[model samples]
Target: MSDPVTFALTVLALLLGAAVLTALFSGAKALTSVAHVPLVIACGLSALLAIFLVSKVAGADTPQFVSAPVTWFAAGKFAANFTIAVDPLSAMMLAMITFIATFIAVFSSGYMRGEHGEPDAGYVRYFAVMSLFVFCMCGLVLANNFLLLVGFWEGVGLCSYLLVGYYYDKPSAAAAARKAFLVTRLGDTGFLLGIMLLWKLGGWHTDLTALFDHIAKNPPPTEQITAACLLLFCGAVGKSAQFPLYVWLPDAMEGPTPVSALIHAATMVTAGVYLVARCAPLFALAPDAQAVVAWAGGITALLAAFIALAQTDLKRVLAYSTVSQLGFMFLALGTLGAVSPVFAVVAAMFHLFTHAFFKALLFLASGSVMHAMGNVIDMRRFGGLRTVMPTTHLTFLCGAAALAGLPLLSGFWSKDLVLESLQFGAHSGHPHAGSFYLLMLVAMLTAGLTAFYTFRAYFLTFWGPTVVPEEAGHHAHESPSVMTVPLIVLAAGALFVGIVAEPFTHWFSGFVGRTPSIGLAAKLAGAAEVAHHFNWGIAGVSTLLAVGGVALAYMAYGAGGPERVPVPLAGVFALSRNKLYVDEVYEGAFVKPAEWLAVMARVFDLLLDSVSRVIAAVPRLVGVAVRPIQNGLVQFYALSMALGLAVFLSFVVFRAGR
Candidate 1:
């Protein structure tokens, strides 16, 4: 009963209890309100526990805590156990999840309140699901073994499906939930296969620590390791909304804004990034798999950024931005892993840490704006909101700046580290240098695009004449203190989290396990040196790109610019607006074929039914033909028997003659 273990289990219990209480009281108003008390208390306690664990981890040189394993089940050479492990990485993630979730819960208390300031009927359900989601994310982060990780991974996915379709009566919301589930399920399938492969390789050992140690001591074949890594990364791709499987995320905006914030910022989306970082040891053995991850991330970053540029819905624009930002994280992981495994893992986790704060702020701020505009998220319909919602505007601007990677903001430090990693990879003379160089160029371009769309949404929403739609009524005002306070807190983080980038990186290096190679370690040290020195050339270029993007946005959408531009590049605009027709392409390729298959299946089903009917008719026909033979009259039976006997005798005589 160590303090750390006690605290960890206590946190888990509190969250589980919160979820259960809310579920139980969902139908009773007074009881539901009482239930929320425990929910908030659980959130607060979890945050405090997270802080304690993070402090303990950061203060110690060797920060590892593992609970005594409790066997859940056992079989020959195979067993599942319940265990919790906390190290620097998991500690940091736990801190971030609980902390952000606390604020979101507090903010939701206001945002989800009824018109008269009472809790809504569904409020209890929302908090219940939210609490459950927190528990699942914690489980995923703190799991000592891959089995628990996968279980919690699916748990979070299920919670997301429930939360996203919270408004089940809304057709769009229901459809979005299904889409998210099905799309991510595709990746989970690959993840499951990878797990099985690893389990077999390790002789049924699935404990992550033991598994990694085995792989490091006796490295598997290149082909096997590469295949496993690729399969595992497929889950990351879908969960994090990478290329090909990213269609679900944009549509997921149909959920409540708090759910969006949670998904994008603190919980579900981040699970993928965490998964890759957690398995950095396995990936280090497979360079080919790392390269695939790098390319997929780079391309997704560019593609999603371009798509964001033409989006009009405020939340949808941010939704695409999240996809692009996630791509950058993977790019960092991929490039750096190939050249410098330790730094790559650190850099990826760093970006994930910083992204949670700013992205959450942005989404919540958008929710505020939507509230004032009669729930209208279309940027084309509203303008000049700064005067009415100054707090929201300022907070959103801060978040937007950070997202754009403007110098000195949280995004700049982490994103610059990623870009510098790519540069180092290209120069490291690795076999993958050419691809690394190409990816670096793509990442840099995506940086500029990121800036453009972020500010584009900002300018169009807050600048120009105040054009509140008539349908919204006359009173557009600042959100209540409950909502505004979270914005302020998150805005401060967005502004200052970059300041600790160096120390954070150094600290993170200690937690990602051992370096795979001395050569790789040397390269990583060099990358760290470059980052420490703050390469002015790289910073200057990135800052210029960011500023140039903002300037271009201002020119096009600022007060003096045309309210509606009549651009001549209609085709390009159309393509960007249509998300480069990726959805359409998927519809044609996968959806249509599946539909055709379904139709063919139906035809086969019908034909089988018809054949079954024909087969069934023979029994009925025989029964009908023999119906009169079963009459209960004794005389009739005797007469029929006599006639049958006579006929039988005639047949016998004829047969004998023949």
Candidate 2:
């Protein structure tokens, strides 16, 4: 079918509606709660993947897609389109969101089995939210209009809030959710403004195909286009969590591990890049806006990479890493056409794919450990878990290697591709690019820091003597195959995805509409082997950095166990320990000022309302004086009417002359 949007919505509607109905009709004991949910999602995920594969390849060149707009309301001028239209980009995103979500769903069957008092309360709630989340992401990416996308965008954000605050009993968890929502809303205003500008520029043509169709024939005024670009960037920054607006991601770890895995790693955070990719034509003409994007993304990547280096909490590190990685994606978008936009987009999207696998793997492995050790995530409370939980330790190590961008891992291919694009970008003379060499140097350094910090976390948690009290759990063992299987699957994906990057790149090109770049060495190696012919020196240097970092971490933290680490760098190491105080700086700069402005708004409203009431009373008091002037007298009314007539005539005469 040409109509991917309609197909996706129908699919989501069926999946969610069926899940709810099953929950109702199956009764409490018949379906056995969350077990039913995982099974249901498995079925839905499989169906969606089948559809995505069939549709993505089928409709690569044809735009004869049918519109199946389900209107929420209809008015003369404004009506909402629950519009779904899956082109290549949308199809690809749908595949990712559903696939990873399904993995989390399946993995959770075992991980979440005993979380709440009821054997499956957490999974049941998680499934409902997760299914809704998948629906939102699919709907968002496939939406044919800005309004439709916004509806689904906000839907995804809403689920982000709910899932983040899933542990409502934990005040910190609830606060983290609030923080994320509030911070994102700040950026969403820009997104809305951009949408409005877009509508204004091309009224009666705001749908995706229509906008492209209109612009294809006639470009809008430069001012309108630039404004739209800025506004969209605002939305992107908010959703993607960049630069000034990125304060919330680190705290996002307060959510459940699976929630963190799904929401942050795979789906919600990538929406911004999808938006940019979908509307690349518009952004292509907005040079100034692209420059802003480049600077913002470059600074964010460099900044967040360093912050991630200093974080101690396992998931927080990944949170900052996600933010940093997203910056790299935006940076590529900024340099569009410099090095084929298709290549950039493919690299970014592939990174998104690989990051989802490895990041989710890391989070779930950490979850296994936390479950084993009574929810202890502090790296210092762990050590030498190679024996106790071989599966988790090995899985974490594999995920860590992938994340560190070592050789043939999925992350290595994607990340280096992004960097290579940035490296070659400036030569193309796009105003959006900077000195490629400098950017490459900066990127290389960031890679080193990323490797170091990631390995530090890995080593402290699983490579030394057991720092966990010996009595923690004699049964502290490997998780079930349900959990380990997902890890294995992700690890396998992470390992070989790079080796086959060429095919993935080819598959991804169905969206970006450009031929994939052929790195000669890569092609010669045939996508089946790791070849280091072109940039062997860079590879050796970067690899050395990672290994060195791991060695240092081993010396410092892996001595015996976590307890042997230097105490000075422990506990109240709030600055380095808390990620270079970036959060504090943000609080001091933006959050506090916003809070103050809110307070001022409240105070101003109170004062203005009180003054307005007092002014209103004065008019009433003056009415008493006027009443005395005309105390029940028809003669007084007649005199006042005559005076008013005379004044009106005089004013009319004066205005005519003037």
Best by TM-score: 1
TM-score for predicted model 1 compared with the true structure: 0.93
Model 1, which residues run further than 4 Å from truth?
Answer: 33-35, 501-532, 560-562, 566-569, 631-658
lDDT of 1 by residue, 457-485 (tens): 99999998887876568677888998999
Clashes of each: 0, 4
| Candidate 2 local lDDT, 1-658, one digit each (tens) | 3345445656666656645654463346545554446445544554566356545545556533446667766689877665556555555666666767667777776766664325554555666676677777777876777887898899999989998998888999999999999989988999998888777676556676666656545678767787898898888898889988888877888888878888887779888877777777677666677667767877788788777765667788888888888887887676655665556566677778788888888888888887777676766566778888998888889989988888778777777767766765766666545655667677777777788778878877787675564445555677778788888877787787666644434544444343112222122212222211235565677677767766766676655453343577554344556666777787898879989999999999999999999999998999987877767889988998999999999999999999
* Alpha carbon lDDT at 86, candidate 1: 78
| Clash tally for model 2 | 4
Error of 2 at 637 (Å): 23
The per-residue C-alpha lDDT of model 2 at residue 87 equals: 51
Strongest candidate by lDDT: 1
